[model samples]
Target: MSTLDAWTHGEHTHDGTTHPVYRRGTGPGVVVIHEIPGMTPEFLAFADEVVEAGFTVVLPHLFGTPGRPVGAGYVLDTVRRVCVSNEFTKLATGVTTPLAGWLRSLARELHAELGGPGVGALGMCFTGGFALAMMVDTAVVAPVLAQPSAPFPVGPTRSRDVNLSPEDLAVVKERAAGGCQVMGLRYRQDPAVGQRFETLAHELGDAFVRVEFPGRKHSTLTLHRQQEAVDRVLGFLDEKLRA
Candidate 1:
């Protein structure tokens, strides 16, 4: 893989702070939200692949809680602060809220930069619902949610309530009804994501496409499964975004 500097870099003003964002590629825009690892090497490779597939991608540093930059690899400590203390989901939701506005601004700017309609956004496990949240941004035409995990507060009462506020869900639901396809990926074993899909399916009606990677686990659907998880996700994105 080749390392290319983000053509655009700036402070993403969100939640009373300015976080950094890396923008690369030269086609349609794709907002690539990283996993709990921040912008790790693997996630960067995923971003590069999306770029190679002909889409500009933006990687956001959602975990900006001091000393936590992109690719920090502070997973253990992150767990303590985020998961154990439940602050991780809180931090993530804060950024997810402002991200929709940031994407719209980025999309408009990128459209002038790349000369296209707008951008496509991909949110992974820790950030899967983020993509759904950004669907309210008109510039975000194509949205893909991959293994959305966290705050499994979904049931008949809170299914579409993970990370996103109720207002965001209503708007995104409207977009899906108007032809925006929300494609979701998850391993049946990942209960958090499974519950997410269950709730979202109802609010989204028939516009949501949830694909379960059989025998796959919580780890990217690559663990314990012979099938390649990356290939499956890429194919799904290609079908959805590569139009």
Candidate 2:
């Protein structure tokens, strides 16, 4: 049985593009974007935690088979698809992924419906930096980036890139300066995450909350599953959205 069976499913269409969305829980709204290779059981478990924490959680099905467990072959296949997809910007710097616009639209609609200060956006792994990109929109108040690996981290330049265009980065910086805080979590030695956390600290200064765990693990909220990180994320959402 798929864990998603308990959630209400729907489709969100924006600018002629549409994607399946799974929703559950109630209270404030949160858009939880899953990592590469689809929304695995672990990912759904994390979303369940968010839902149980008192927020209405929305999981956007971007790629990969929903409910599929993570495996080497599955990861490779999904990586290939994401690399070829026009919606994602894999090896490029100074540009936000096109899918972020769709995600921002979803956040907007959620905030509009919930009528709170704003909604929260959390992205993990390959889709990690997306939360920061969505933060460009005012609808996203609590933006959490968990092990954001983007631009492929091929070279030194790409390794440090946060996957945001200069224009978008500028707005994010402005928003950060205006009291909007961005939270990030990753393993201290995870090469997949590159130096993006350092870049974030440099770019957003104190507005960027950096959370690092010991050792080398990729997914902070899911696969790696750090309890402290999860608590930090939930606390951040509560502080920014409910408080």
Candidate 3:
């Protein structure tokens, strides 16, 4: 059986949409959104680390097989699904994917049940920018974007867009302006991330704390799994959710 078989699974529903969510640990809440190809072992390991760090980690299975390995076939299947799904903007720029709204609702519900300076959110890869979009709601205070790649990074416009709707972007800007900072991680040479960090810096000003590394390493918490970045993420969570 897969390691995910041991995680407590449930469904989180919002606006008539329900997604499977795997939760573990207790105390402050921290939603850890997975990357492409489903909730792989690497992603689950990262979630376990967050749980060990003393927060209830929620991993929502948005796509792909729940516990499938990362292979070319799995990757292609997930990519195709995301491309056709209305939940994601896929090729669109300057528009928040409709799925982000549901995620925000999930964050709000989690926070309402277990409160401590609000809940934390960490989105990686395809779902990386989702945490930023979820920040439009006050419940998500600790937002972490790990190599956020959405809208496919196909062209210049999509590369620079943060994947947020105009109204949601305005709310994020206002929140950042009001002292709610957002953390981000990316490799300087990772094409998947495009110019997202540059756009974030331009939009969020001093509120965006970026931890950029050299080379083409991707996925700060998994796959590449930089120890320093992982520690930084846990530290950020502690500071935001614990203290």
TM-score of each: 0.75, 0.98, 0.97
Score candidate 3 by lDDT.
0.90
- Candidate 1 residue lDDT tens string, 144-183: 7777775444453333445676677778888888888887
Candidate 2 per-residue lDDT over residues 133-243, each given as its tens digit: 999999999999999999889999999999999999999999999999999999999999998998999999999999999998788888889999999999999999996
Candidate 3 clash pair list: 96-165
Error of 3 at 131 (Å): 0.3
Positional deviation of residue 176's Cα in model 1 after best superposition, in angstroms: 0.8
Top-scoring candidate (lDDT) = 2
Off by over 4 Å in 3: none
TM-score of 1: 0.75
Q: Candidate 1, 92: how far from true, in Å?
A: 12
Top TM-score: which candidate number? 2
Off by over 4 Å in 1: 1-10, 14-16, 64-73, 80-100, 152-160, 221-243
What are the lDDT scores of the predictions, listed in order?
0.63, 0.94, 0.90
Predicted structure 1: lDDT: 0.63
